[model samples]
Target: MSANSKVVDINKNREELITFTEEEVETIKRTVASDANTDELKMFLHVAKSYGLDPFNKEIFFWKVKGKPTIMTSRDGYLKIADRHPQYDGLVSDVVRKNDSFKRKSDGIEHEYGTERGDIVGAYALVYRKDRSYPVYVFAPFEEYRADTKVWYKYPSAMILKVAESMALKRSFSVSGLVSREEMDVQQLEEDKESPTKRFKKQKEKEDYIDVKDNAQDDSLSQREKEIKRIVGKSPKLKNDLLNYLEHAKKENDIGEEEKMSINKLDDQQFTQLKSILQTFKRLA
Candidate 1:
């Protein structure tokens, strides 16, 4: 999102016509440059488009995970996508407790929410169509677990039902381009604003592979690192000249610490900036 741009929350049942504009996204590019990478921003856009959500209208959202953007939608967004398809008589949902399922009959309008009963897991949905013999079954589980707190950060009941609902909708109507909002980031949307410490606290809490020193034992790479590799993989011409570009960037930025540094070794911010710059070069090439 841009400094001037804002996202508005809407009802779960409401339908919206979203159109992403160049200006709005360009602003995102500028804003992300300071903290996030171009690929992260680009992935947000791609996921939004592929899933048919619009950030401009707040149908979906961008979350800052470890100072990088991750795509996610609010409970409202999850619900909105769920109700898009037509329902059949076979439509049924249930509340899950431990390993047992409590069958709940639906009136086709009212949904039965899950419970906090013994080891309350999540809700289940069975979406059916006119032609299909078997109803499309979907399991929507809670994704708000916080390892640090050893608890689920999001409301259990809120997530349980919506997870089931969204799952049913996506599996039943996936061709219409629906994406699951589960496991996506929603910290910013949940709050109007948070303190910087609180904002980055989530990042610190999450265990990510970061290589700051020239010699490190951890060879595992983060999602951002993988994204850089994918971006580089797109352009053979640019990939061949990556070393030269890296050298120029280091010289221009006044960095002479290490003559040799792999692209994966660059920190998140540096990698993001480099990817953006290389993308421009890729386009030209």
Candidate 2:
């Protein structure tokens, strides 16, 4: 066959191998890639199919920051990719506390801690490959990855360990085009008022990977509504700011009266829309 014919055949074969049904594709677009445009959705599906990821199972997800698409995978998703590699062996990881006896020897890391290990300071992950003599090791400091988010606040050690493990797995397996949840700092993204593409470009300059927001869409509709309401409820300043912004937008005829309803009275879809409007308002402010 000619070179062009061979390329066409490979593309056809790949398309035939995709297992996501049309319904699933619609669901993915509506929920996971809700903010994605057509070109963004195409790129997302290409990466998903290339990695044999199941969006239905959330092995990978789509997020957008300021209109720029960001693809994210879990640590388990990275491990899943590694497991499919023939050279994969196993993995070991741990978080180091302030009192832990941690040392970096020639072969691998030595970490020891007791019940009273105090506060977590850092974490390390080691990925063993059957073809390699030594394991791929990565260390992540707590301060580097920790954020002022609910997840980080509640599960600091687990989150940092995930960061270390994701780094190690990507290094060992050459995984590309995916960022784990542990690497993202949504608060930082919000606080940085740069253009969406510019903010991501700056992050890429530093980390060479896309950044994702929180795992908010993973929750159910009712759960998301409650979470959104809870977030607005806790921040008196945020609530006041949102109300004022909505009132201003109303005066400009940008939004309607329904958008000004109390957060508790809004339904699921309205809550999501309200949250999105609030984000846009914050960005503009």
Candidate 3:
């Protein structure tokens, strides 16, 4: 198939593919010139080959790992090294407990956060285009490990290709510009203003008021009427009816026949629909 045909097929499967912008490419070139190391250069070659770009593309830039190297030979070696280094011992213990699937070394170096073990020490690099210039980050892990001897071998080019393909899949959809440090600080400040407990308490208070209102409208015979009124004021339906009934009952000096009948009818309805409401008031009393 033609190159265009292959590109079409790839695009069909991965719809988010984006080419680098010119400015991004130039920045990458500068970074590569200033800081590219052997490992980063290797990763770049791996990424380029997987993307069907020339492995020696002039525009590509690579970033190298920095800081003190932590080396591990075997599980015992890792532990030994960690025990000697206070800062790294905790990390080693955490990895041993959490990463049961991996073979660890005793004495070499502590693994940094975001590092994954393949067969050897895993490392990361960024790939940028010379033409357009967006960064595509790549992670390469050791391909083979000897548990007893504490040796790791470089992952093969084919394995590296797979890793590169995975990185491409991720980069294709990723946003280029990231939130600045200042923006992140502002976001954290806003979040700190409202804690989870405070938000929950506010929601619960609103719900309690609603419950009190609903109960008042449905219960007239409730002995805890005073308490309910205090909770959510008098219900509109019950307020007028209750006032009129009280007034009439007081004027008659004794229960009138019509009033007695109306009271009885209301009692019967309450026994059926508002039984639970009455029970709640009784409990409160």
Candidate 4:
């Protein structure tokens, strides 16, 4: 049968699956508010299994690719959670400071004292990209801490509840553009003239394609032509005989026997002597 006909039959055998319901989406939002462990995030798994939709998957992918949310942590970490709501930010900040290591850095001329170490607290921030999605905004004590050894701390559930109350009280503070350093660098490059690295990469890729195309053209040969070329020193009659034998072996599904015989013939002492002579001819050619 034709390739297209086989594809249609295969497609017909496959089944479609439904993802999550509206109620399930609401349940997910509620579950995210608590300190849910990796296993506790079963709702997300179910959604992924059903429809292959994952909200946190993109965040994780971005984190893996860009190496943590640096910019978000830098900006959000300084925001006084207590000022927005009575003692809310202070409570979370206090917990983070106590649990983790913090350092002070000079804001150029002025020394701004901020928590530089401890468990980081993350909240859903407004998506910075044109795509309207929520990205997690991490608030930590400091941005200079080593990612490998530094222990990150999270705010207490009670503090999160307080912040949620303040969020409900005043809906003025909207989550805005919070992008990673890598993402910002890419954006800056797009705004400027073509970057040198990008131009070099494009030129290298074009050259590679040209080389591949030329090599492919040089390698292109029909099966019969290949057989004739491989058996160059042999008589035309012998080459034709070998080709015919190969065709018959393929048709009868007896290729293994022919392959063994072909290997044995090539390995013969006489064949090796002939090959040495052919190599001398190749050097002269």
Better-scoring candidate (lDDT), 2 or 3: 2
Candidate 2: Cα lDDT at 116: 81
Model 4: per-residue Cα lDDT over 80-181, one tens digit each: 221333323221122233333333222111112355543433211111222223222222213222121111122233233323222322222332323322
Report the C-alpha lDDT of model 1 over 184-249, residue by residue, as the tens digit: 222323552567697467433321222222222236655655665656663333443354445444
lDDT of 2 at 186: 32
Give each model's whole-structure lDDT. Answer: 0.49, 0.64, 0.31, 0.29
Segments in model 1 whose C-alpha atoms lie over 4 Å from true places: 1-17, 30-42, 64-69, 82-94, 97-121, 140-154, 175-181, 184-285
Q: What overall lDDT, based on C-alpha atoms, would model 1 receive against the true structure?
A: 0.49
Stretches > 4 Å off in candidate 4:
1-56, 62-201, 204-285
Superposed Cα deviation of residue 20, candidate 2 (Å): 2.5
lDDT of 4: 0.29
Q: How do the predictions measure up, each by TM-score?
A: 0.42, 0.65, 0.15, 0.15
Candidate 2 lDDT tens digits, 110-218: 8877788788888899999999999998989887667554456767888788889989999998878888766555345346556779856764442222111122353
**Residue 89 error, candidate 3, Å:** 42
Q: Residue 153 error for model 4, in Å?
A: 42
